[model samples]
Each structure stands twice: as structure tokens, then as C-alpha cells.
Target: MRTLAVTTMDPRHRVLCRIRIEGAEEAEKICLLMGSEVAPRRQFIAAGATELDEARIDI
Candidate 1:
């Protein structure tokens, strides 16, 4: 499998949630599950700078 990502950020560009997936659909689903909107469609070419929304209880 490959990696895709979805994220949410506050107006200040602070990370709210970041998650991994195999494709775009999963990314959106993750954001929904977290009650957030997906960040600008992004590239997850590598796990360079991703962090899960710290406010989330799942992590």
C-alpha cells in the first residue's frame, strides 16, 4: 500500500489533525470522523511533516 494524508488546521495554520491512508477517500473519511474539514488538498509523498490533531482523543 502507499500513503495519502488528510489534515485540518485552525485559521492560524495550526495542525488539528493529520492522518494516513491509502488514497484520497480514506483521507476525507478520517477528517469527517474527527469532525474536521480537510486541509487544502496536499501531497503526502513522504511522512515528512505530519502530526495528528493533538486535540483528538484517538491518539
Candidate 2:
């Protein structure tokens, strides 16, 4: 089950990066691949049909 997630800042919640992943479990790996530190204050959002359209990540 592939999904899309966006890592964001802590207080501002500004989107730092976006990625298309394999599953919910891949969220952490994606963060690391993007160079997140020991405990990066970020966020992850899975993509549904609508979200895919919005984010425009090629499947």
C-alpha cells in the first residue's frame, strides 16, 4: 500500500518535503532519507485519491 507523506516544521507546520512511500511503516525511513536528525520535529500525511491529485506525486 503506497502512500504520500510531507514532513513539516514543528510550530509553523510548514511543509519541508514530500515523498511517495510504500506503506505507513515507510514514514520513518522517508524522513531519514530526507536527512532528518535524531528526532526531527516533522509531520507525515498519507495520500488518498484526492490527496494524490493535490500533491501531484506520480504513481
Candidate 3:
């Protein structure tokens, strides 16, 4: 029998380094790069704060 150690981290403190989407092989690289760019932004928006269309993104 083997035992594995597990660590849990709070989502609020999570460092979004990489994002991988299943079945999106070609898009994975693009997604990872985009995530890195987007994660550092201080949106000041909480979860469930706004609907999809209500969200504002500064381009």
C-alpha cells in the first residue's frame, strides 16, 4: 500500500500559473498565455458578482 501527501490551498490565495483545457490541445498554449496575462489584473470583482454580459473588460 502507498500513501500520498496532499495539500489544499485557498482559492483566494491561489496563484493562477497555468490553465489546461481537456480536448483543446491547440488552444491550451493560447489559454495558458492568456491566463497569465489576465490573472494578475485587480478586477475587484467577487464570485457571483456579475452575470456574463454584465462583466466589463478593458481592452
Candidate 4:
């Protein structure tokens, strides 16, 4: 198993989600999965969809 640190930043909302994963190559995979799931939700609440696309994540 490998440990990965995932960090996400939503500039529009000024929110951040940092997660640590324990698995084999799960860090990068989980980061994208979580971003895909949350980006849309954030877009719905944001001024526009593009806001979420601008979101940044460091893995």
C-alpha cells in the first residue's frame, strides 16, 4: 500500500479539502475522482460552471 496526500482548492468559495489516502496508487486516482464529484456540485452553487473548472488541486 502507498500513502498519498491530496489537496484541493476552490478559489471561488475559498474552500479547501485535503485528504490522505492509504492504498496502491490511490492518491492520484482518488484526487481526480473526488474533484470530478465535487466540481459539479461546487459549480451549481457557484456563480457559474467555469468557477469549478478553475479550481486547483495539488497532489
Candidate achieving the largest lDDT:
4
lDDT of each: 0.45, 0.47, 0.44, 0.49
lDDT per residue as tens, model 1, 1-59: 32233322334434655554556686764445344444432333223246655576442
Give the total clashing residue pairs for model 2: 0
What would the TM-scores of all predictions be? 0.21, 0.19, 0.19, 0.19
- Compose the digit string of candidate 3's lDDT tens values, residues 1-59: 32232222555434455545664774553445445566533342333346545445422
**How high is the lDDT of residue 33 in model 4?**
41
- Using TM-score as the measure, the top candidate is 1
Q: Encode model 4's per-residue lDDT on 26-51: one tens digit a residue.
A: 44654454565887556445644455
Q: Is candidate 3 or candidate 4 better by lDDT?
A: 4
- Lowest summed lDDT window (length 10), candidate 3: 1-10
> Arrange candidates by lDDT, highest first: which order?
4, 2, 1, 3
Candidate 4 ranges with C-alpha deviation above 4 Å? 1-14, 30-59
Model 2, 1-59: lDDT tens per residue?
A: 53243334353435554545555566765546467454433433332334546455534
Native-to-model Cα distance after best TM-score fit, residue 28 in candidate 1, in Å: 0.6
lDDT comparison, 1 vs 4, better candidate: 4
lDDT of 1 at 23: 66
